[model samples]
Target: DQQVKQNSPSLSVQEGRISILNCDYTNSMFDYFLWYKKYPAEGPTFLISISSIKDKNEDGRFTVFLNKSAKHLSLHIVPSQPGDSAVYFCAARGYTGKLIFGQGTTLQVKP
Candidate 1:
């Protein structure tokens, strides 16, 4: 039920600034961490991910960090743009690729 949690419900940031989103999980069995971005009328899309063996992973302007010991993870977006405004969801995948999702955090980037 509460295996995954997003402490923040929403966040606002100026365009071209950085946006940080946080997530925590209670299940240590999760080995794969992923961040998904969703627009209001569309399904969520995969953004970034990090494996449990690695503490951090980066792709272009996005980065995902995982702390296995603390059961915490975070997504970072650098130079955030208006197009980046959306709901972000943190998800965990086990070895089988089954995902458990946290309550989404809505991000708003002002132009």
Candidate 2:
């Protein structure tokens, strides 16, 4: 069963604007949240992460928020740039320490 899901398959945002990516999960056992950014053929790289104990975490232009009660999480990018365009994957780790990922959302940052 798919535990994580990204309802929107894609998102478009203007350069220099804020871009928000949303993800939903059904598993309450998940203990960690992470977002990965992938460019074309390249493998997805760690972008940002938030622990289940925290409601928010920020790293530079990126921020991740976890809402345990709602079983949802989001990634925010401020002042998005063209180079930031890529496929974003939302992942969660459960008791097994194995990651479950959602259907990626492709982000298009237009300059």
User: TM-score: which candidate is best?
Assistant: 2
Residues 25-110 of candidate 2: C-alpha lDDT, one tens digit per residue? 99998889999999887898999998889999999999999889999999999989999999999999988978999999999999
Top candidate by lDDT:
2
Question: Cα-based RMSD of the predictions, in order?
Answer: 0.9, 0.7
Local distance difference test scores for all models: 0.94, 0.95
What tens digits encode model 1's per-residue C-alpha lDDT throughout 12-72?
Answer: 9999999999999998888899999999889999998898899999999999988888999
Off by over 4 Å in 1: none
Alpha carbon lDDT of residue 12, candidate 2? 100
- Weakest 10 consecutive residues of candidate 2 by summed lDDT: 39-48
For model 2 the TM-score comes to 0.97
Q: Where in model 2 is the C-alpha error above 4 Å?
A: none
**Model 1 per-residue lDDT at 89:** 98
